[model samples]
Target: MYQLAPNIELLFTEAGDYHDRVRAAAAAGFSSVEMWGPTGVDAPSTPKDLPALKAALEETGTTLEAQLAEPRTQFMIPPWDHSEFFRKLDEGVEIARELGTPRIVVGSGTGFGGWKRQVQLDKLIEIYQKAIAQIDGSGVTLVLEPVNVRVDHPGSLLDRTSEAVYVARGVDSPSFGVLYDIYHSAVEGEDMRAELAGAGDLIRYVQLADAPGRGEPGAGSIDWVERLGWLRASGYDGPIGLEYYPTIESAASVRHIVEVAARA
Candidate 1:
């Protein structure tokens, strides 16, 4: 059976506060939750109460599956100084350690206008190589996520699963891998089954929202049952994060997909 982790940042909004959302998720029968960043001070900041968030997790026995290393600056693109990026990463690592979160998500910022794609890819590998060094022995894994450009992220540097896999292979560290967001992949018209097959163990994490609408599973065009079943059959036994907007009540919205995932 697959483990379900609700993205507290999006789901459980009825609870109002981030900490309360953790309790809400736990009450609704979810054992784990994920979030964007700790401080919530990133672009389009969510500024959470870290103390309360931590207490909620401890009290509810809810595990923090992962969190995004926020403010996705131009770290992966050209003129790649990555100085501030590393500093933020250090802070994020400290927070992750405090929260007992084992994984942190990262993004490939927009591509440089003047640089070739190959050069950008090389720079990403170099940057992540340094990133791995920075977080070495932190016991936290870094998951590189690829966002879709066709709709959501217009100028994102990395939009393909193949490219993410390539970069992860280049990094070649046990502590670094890819986060395959099914919603983004489907939005970009990717062949999900083939990509998952190709990703294998390099896929360190997975997030899902329905395609076309970025809503709950039944709200979009993709086949949740078939696709989720494929993920299970492919041996990806990691936590499957629910990262979507609810068309109805959060708890009610997730019931079917949770059942589908359970069967998968």
Candidate 2:
């Protein structure tokens, strides 16, 4: 069976504060939750009170599934500067350790405007290899996310799951993997089965939002029952993150997903 982790950054807007949002998720019966980053800039700024957020998680008995690591700073593509990227990654690792988060999501910046495709890909592999070395024993897994260019994240170099899988395969480290976002894959017109076949065990984390609108599961055209069922059958027994924008009240918007998970 697959576990569900709500992305508190997008969900539980009824509660204005970050810690309160964690509380809201727990109140809604979610035992695990995910977020964009510790800085809170991705959704809101939760930078001031991580201890309070930790306390809320402890109080509510909630566990964090994963979080993005300095998403604003692009590391996977372009100029390929390892200095600032490594610095931010160290900071992110410390925060993850503090919060007991096991995985960190990474974004591949826009493709190099003037570089050759093969050269860019080779450079990306080198960057990730060095990054994996930086966090060699941190016990935190880094997941490279491929955002779709069709509707969101246009100009991004790593917009296809196959490319992410290829990068992960080249890195070939247990600490490195790909973050397979179902919505992004669907928007890219990828056959999930085929792409996932290539990804195999390199998929360390999974996130979801309905395509076309990036809303609640049932709000879009994707078949939640079928796709999620495919995930289970494919041997991916990991948390499926709820990273959608709510179309209705936060709690109400997730009811359909909860039902589907229960039946799944």
Candidate 1: tens digits of C-alpha lDDT, residues 12-81: 9999899999999999999999998778767554888899989999999999999888656566345556
Instruction: Return the TM-score for each candidate structure.
Output: 0.96, 0.94
Q: Number of clashes in every candidate structure?
A: 1, 1
**Model 2, span 1-264: residue lDDT tens:** 567898887899789777899999999889899987787555343563789889988899888899887745464443555687788889889998988899998866875568887677676788889989999999999999999999988888888898888888889999999999999999999999988888889989999999789999999999989998888777788888999988899999998889888777
- Model 1 error, position 7 (Å): 1.1
- Looking at candidate 2, what is the lDDT of residue 108? 68
Best by lDDT: 1
| Model 1 whole-model lDDT (C-alpha atoms) | 0.89
